[model samples]
Target: MPKKLKLILINSSILLIGIILIELCFGGWFSSSNQLSNLGIIKDAKFEFDVRNLYATKKQSITYTRDKFGLRGISTYNQPEKIKILTVGGSTTDQRYLDDSQTWQEILEKTYRDNGKEMYISNAGVDGQSTYGHLKSTEIWFPKIEKLQPEIILFYIGINDFYRVNSDAKYDDIQQMESGGFVSQIKDKSVLYNAYRKLKGIQKATKFEVGHRKINFSRTPYTQEEIVNEKLLEIYDKKNLTAFKSRVKKLIVYAKSVNATPIFITQPTLTYRIRNGVVYGTEATKYLEEKYAYNGVGYYKLLSKLNDAITEVAGKKYVINLSNEEDWNIMDFYDYYHNTPIGAKKIGEKIYQNLTELGFVK
Candidate 1:
């Protein structure tokens, strides 16, 4: 091995590695964009949206889009007349902060696609909606989407309804469902196309926006000690339970009307933390106390009660109560009730597995 020859080979290897890294980073592998809320943020005639109000300040290059049917992920222009699954819920299900590639709905969609299965799953999540909103959806929204009925309607309930337990919050307002054209730009296979999108996104984020202000994500982290104070929260009131039960039943009825099976899934809150293999049940931000009479501990407990109501009302066989079954670290959520990408992946995978086990997805 001559000295000059050895040096040339080493330099060539370094160059090759550099090229690959650039391709991966600038390629679709690492490129992403925070889609404008206009693309999927669900602005009903009733929603007086301030973009600042709907998303985290620290926007990333994550793509989020909704079809005319208001379903997240790929547009219905590419879907079958009868979609297989539709997940309904509030912000947790809407997953506004997550890119289309990262939302649990899309994650579920990809899983089926990868397994030689072609199942179309749409996300019908709206921020701040509850069972009440879903009932409204059955009436005003879902009926409008043309030939877009799903076989399984996953009702990811509990979190937003938790507020209505002891307090009076009109947690209902979601856009009417829409169905139409959309192709997923999130995980495009062409690296060149991805690169072009990234450049445009950079421009959009920097100089293109005048109506939106850049707000950073809240960095404050909560601890179980800070949120829980030994006193237990009261079970959700019987009146609320009755109302909640009625709502769930309505959703079920709506599902049956569409020949869809309604499965009530209990969504977990960011109220608790997981540490050292032990799970802490009641824990969330102290700021929650401002909105509700109780702290995070109470919020967690109350939400669980609402969860129990759904299970008890809808029957456990039709519910996947992630609130009681899953354990996620604080990192799973940006706040008390929304998922980060990491959190979304865990959730999406879990739901897919549950559906498979339950024979909802073959």
Candidate 2:
């Protein structure tokens, strides 16, 4: 063979190998096994569902329907005369696992209507939100609520606030926002973003299952209830407590300025009990300790401080202590922090009852 021809052939072979290696690494070829295993799908089986089509489609109407974001019903304008209620909170208020009909907001709306009182309720809950997020949302969406002229604004928050307040997570305030880090920058790259955008459905489902697997593997022995009373208590201090209080106060003043009665509900968490002469921690506590050896007592203390602050801001009339009552069991919680449909219904009923007493509802 000619020396130049031989060298060309060798270079081509090396180039082919390099291309194959690149395809295997960042091209997601090597990620298939892990994705399939997480999905519990058969190896080499072609996926039938178009996950992109499923998730990417925009919802048209809100009435009597669920949105891609898992929110129930629609926002209606110029409804017949009835008491209007607006719910604002995080995932618990969003009711991700529950259908539109099963959410507490829906339950409360139905109850009010059943009792011969006309009412309209709008759910302004978003998942993975914090107190600051709620405040921001209110600032943005208050005009929409104003159009409806809701009589009451019910806010269910604290868990996410507690998490963010104690953790090293950076928040983006209007005054000072942090720029994305290196990994975030790469993920935001146009080429990579476009590629993932093309395959977003499969990517999202794969990512979801992977996340669930990771969380399951990282489970701790303690339940959420145990962490609430124990681990959450240990982290309580004056500084964070004061900050939390100031936020609550700001929220109260904001709510009042809108001429909408502000009702704060202290949502519930999973609880533990002494069984067989042994004490068991809640799942959240167990998961936290097993994965990060996190101090549950600290979190509990923080919650205590938050509750205290809420009470101070709301006074006796506005703050609703849902967690304090035995009728509202801690076991009703779906996970470490969120409530099941049944739990949400219970909360909704309590809120309805309170509103009736306060003349917010007839």
In terms of TM-score, the best-performing candidate is 1
Pairs in clash, predicted candidate 1: 32-61, 33-61, 33-62, 34-62, 57-215, 68-178, 68-179, 69-178, 69-179, 271-283
lDDT of 1 by residue, 56-100 (tens): 435435565666556665644335374788888877788765666
- Distance (Å) between predicted and true CA of 183, model 2? 19
Please estimate how well model 2 matches the true structure, expressed as its whole-model Cα lDDT.
0.54
**Model 1 per-residue lDDT at 186:** 35
Per-model TM values vs. the true structure: 0.64, 0.59
RMSD of 1: 18.6
CA lDDT, every model vs. true structure: 0.61, 0.54
TM-score of decoy 1: 0.64
In candidate 1, which residue ranges exceed 4 Å CA deviation? Answer: 1-59, 75-82, 165-235, 274-292
**Each candidate structure's count of clashing pairs:** 10, 32
